[model samples]
Target: MNDFERQLQELFNEVKSMIMMGNKNDAIDLLQANYEAVNEQINAGNKGIEEVAILDIIALGYMYIGDLKFVQSLLDMMSGIVDSLKDDEPLLDAILLHMGSMYSTLENYEKSMLVYQRVINVLESRYGKTSILLVTSLLGMAKVLGSIGRAKKAVEIYHRVITILELNRGTESADLVLPLFSLGSLFIKEGKAVDAESVFSRILKIYTKVYGENDGRVGMAMCSLAHAKCANGNAEEAVELYKKALRVIKDSNYMSLDDSIMENMRIDLAELLHIVGRGQEGRELLEECLLITEKYKGKEHPSFVTHLLNLAASYSRSKNFVEAERLLRICLDIMTKTVGPDDQSISFPMLHLGVTLYHLNRDKEAEKLVLEALYIREIAFGKDSLPVGEALDCLVSIQTRLGEDDTKLLELLKRVLRIQEREFGSESEEVMLTLKKVVSYLDKLGRKEEKFPLQKRLSNLRMKYKQKVQY
Candidate 1:
């Protein structure tokens, strides 16, 4: 390293030591002092690699402190100096990499991709294409592509990374797990479940060979495979795998009982169990989750809200509206206190409570809660969004039970039909059901002109769907 770079490294070592010693303010002061000194040199027309190095270190200090707003300004200054330098500058690679990562963190994906590509070019010129040095930049680029919804391109980049790793460190090397796992997750997200199942199956085999069957990593891989199986329509096998995975992970103690990872796994298994007609088992798991979070995170923690909601759903499914209402109120209170009443999250519990009140024959109270939920969802997700559509559906039912105006009910039904058509195509069964509802409403409103076309459309949909089912 150059003299200036060496001095910069030493200064950062001291900064790190101060931070480790809990002298965070003292470290910030030191960084500020060095930053000012560097600024003075730059202002005096001493703009060089040394000045860039100083600024980069100070920016990194602020980044470590999570003061990204200040780091952004420092990066803006560095960008000007770095742009003036050639691609072959000695410190260019490191500076570009840092900038690429920070830009990604700031959600400036376009700039992040630009710098990451530059770093890849510089590294490829220095070391050949398959060099390990290229992996970091390639992964960064892949992440940016994934963030921007370019899934096919991201999958290609991940495959390239896997190829490079296998070339350097054999196909079975543990190093393959990171990219393989990422590719599998992307496949699942894209609903290519068969592909995801194959990828996750290979990951499970790799982990078993490398870490042994009882290793926590293997258990983790198995959990992923189970999810893929579930997505691919093998619920029975998936349930068995989830049960085994829970046992292995707990036995290994790699994740503590109350760790968020373990907690989430239990919740996932619970939801699946509930879906598979094991509601009692699911309720037990939900209760366990509630106790664990309440013990470790305290009763009013936002984490408890999820467990309460799940249990309430379980009770509601069993027709226990009283208990469900009680749990939902606690959940609603916790959510309102944590994120305030206007947050979109509050709408979920409000809708649930509204439905629960409706089941209890309290139409007035149900109407009030559902109307509030509809207002909140409309503000958060826009009027035509699916969440708003859901709120409208609930409001329609409550209003119908309360014997509201027929004209108003017809409007709500028409809006719901429009939303359903937009979301699930005109030919979808969901749209067909809404079309039937709309037709019924039109008949009640004495709109025979509108009713005739919808009745014909619903008839066509039923015939089409019946033929497909029979085939």
Candidate 2:
């Protein structure tokens, strides 16, 4: 390696050490100093792969410290001159790969995909199409494609990655697990439960063969398999699998008790338990999740809001509005204190509390809270957005309970229908119920002309829905 590249490597290693030691401020200062040194070199007409290397590492350092603004600026600077750099420059490959990942993290998927393609091109030119080294960039491309809803293309790329891994490392090689797991996850998301089950079962077998039955990886695979089973309508078997996986995970100490993954697993199981008429068990699991988050992140931390909200939802589901109210209030207070009262996130607890209050027959209070939530959602998500539509729908229910003006309710329902049409399309089944509500309201108001068109549309939608169901 060149002197500058070697120095950059040492600098990053030191930065990593500082971060591991919880010296984030020191790491940032070190990165800032290096950034200046590299800037001076580029200003002095030494803009080359070595300079790109320094900038890339600095961007990664900022990303590590959760300073995405600096990462974006650095990426912008690199993008200006990256095309001028040689395709075969050794340092350039890693720099491009890091840039691609950073861009993806920043949600600039277009740029991320292009950068990943560039890295793939470099790797392919250097080491044929089947080279194991090409897997990293290919995986990045596949992830971007998946994020953008090109699942078919993403699936193709993932299969290609698996084929390459198998060609180089044999069919049963552990290296195949990454692509297999990714593809399996994609299948689950696409609602191909049978395909997902097969893929996850393959993963379970591979992990068991490689690391034995009690390994953490096997437990994780079992969890995925359980999810597929649940999706396939085998909830009893799925619950058994989930319980066994949890036991294995705990026994193996795969993650700490308060780990986010473990917390989510508990919450997922809690929700599923509630679905299967196990409300008391689900409530206990939700309580456990709350305690875990509270112990690790403190009760007032923003992270505690989700657990509180989940527990509140559980209580609400079981007709315990009083307990749900208390938990919802706690969630609102924590979120409002953490992110300010007007933040979009506060609307979640506010809407839930509105519904809870409505259920308690406190219609006036519910109307006030839902109005505030609707206002916040309109500002944050736009008047026509689905979130705003949800807030509006909640407000409609509260207003109806209050026996508000029929004309006003009718206007609100029409707005909701318009938003649904924009989001779910003009003839989507989702619009049918709202259309019926609108037509019924119009008939109540003696607007036959208005009700006639909507009534006709609703009939057609019902027909289409029935046909789809029958098919």
Candidate 3:
């Protein structure tokens, strides 16, 4: 072998040695040592395994180790090879898409977004926007964006994908289910259960008829249904659906399962387990989910935060307050540092922390945290936002426990009802449910003079919803 080939082979051996010796830092250093040398080899017009083969192995190394820094270095090394393939659109598109994949691996979604834009710019401009590669690129970018908290943008892109798919195949075609799932996930994140249910229902029908009810995809769709049902406040039904889905997944083919999909299923099933109050099962599943996520995305990632927050809630419910409190505080610190103290993302863990404290009969501290979360959410999502209603509901429940017979409590309940109605429409189940709580508050106060109108409105509302339910 020549100098370049000799150096690459030597470096590869060194990397494997470092990893085997449990000296990852040394492995990174070794990769750093040969970084420029590898680029030189790729540029020196080598056509053997030392160039493309070495580069591919190095990329896989960074990816499998799940180190953001090493993955970035691997990407930077690939840039030289890409620069030489400027006129080769296929190669360029593949390179750009691969960059998107790496950024996705790191969950650096904004960077992944820019990489996808490059792919779209090169491919669509060169081969026309109607090409199948363009469609796939758009869908892939949408998926990444959705994963990284840009659900609105992802929803828009999913709609465009749906439009393209529909134009090519029409609504009755199996292609509809793909975009339907994307939209369903987008709706789920935003707490739009009704919309999500509709999309998942469509996907379920198509997937069942096309792939059979016993298929893994049918199971996946059932998982989505379970989540939506949970969001709709039907946890018992969600638990049943999850059990059915789990059975199907366990029996069906595992070869088709991707890591991301499997991780999601793990989380969804864990959440359902929690809904059924099987805290032990949920905690075990969440722990396994965390291990897989840590292997794929590393620690201190938002998804890491998500799983921790979720499990902490389970811990609190299982009466393990200390562990729950520790996780919540870490989450609080991370959210404050990353998104700032006032950002809405801080509200979720805080809300749970407050509720957990309340469950432990620590009302005063719970009130403080819950109010802080409510204030932050109101500032971020407006006074009439559903996020505000969520915090308000938490506070109202706490107030009921504290035996606060104050007008402020009633006013807060009224505000929650108004916000839910404003955001989700007056006939929405969430609005009706909030109104039910308000009626309960009035009932406790024995203010029939004030409660009569609410009682009548609720009866009418109940009738309306009951009729809708029956039909």
Off by over 4 Å in 1: 2-33, 66-73, 320-322, 329-347, 362-365, 368-389, 414-435, 450-471
What order do candidates take by TM-score, descending? Answer: 1, 2, 3
lDDT scores in order? 0.90, 0.90, 0.79
RMSD of candidates 1 onward, in order? 3.9, 3.8, 11.6
In terms of lDDT, model 1 sits at 0.90
Q: Write the per-residue lDDT of candidate 3 for residues 123-239, one digit (tens) a residue.
A: 877877666667777987998988877888888888888877777777666888877887897898888898898888888888888889999888888988888988988888887
Reference-based TM-score of each model: 0.83, 0.82, 0.48
TM-score of 1: 0.83
Output candidate 1 Cα RMSD.
3.9
> What TM-score does candidate 3 reach?
0.48
List model 1 lDDT by residue over 215-236, tens digit each. 9998899899999999999888
The residue ranges of model 2 lying beyond 4 angstroms of the native Cα positions read 2-4, 17-48, 65-89, 106-130, 148-150, 294-298, 302-305, 320-347, 360-392, 398-403, 418-425, 428-430
Provide the clash count, candidate 3: 0
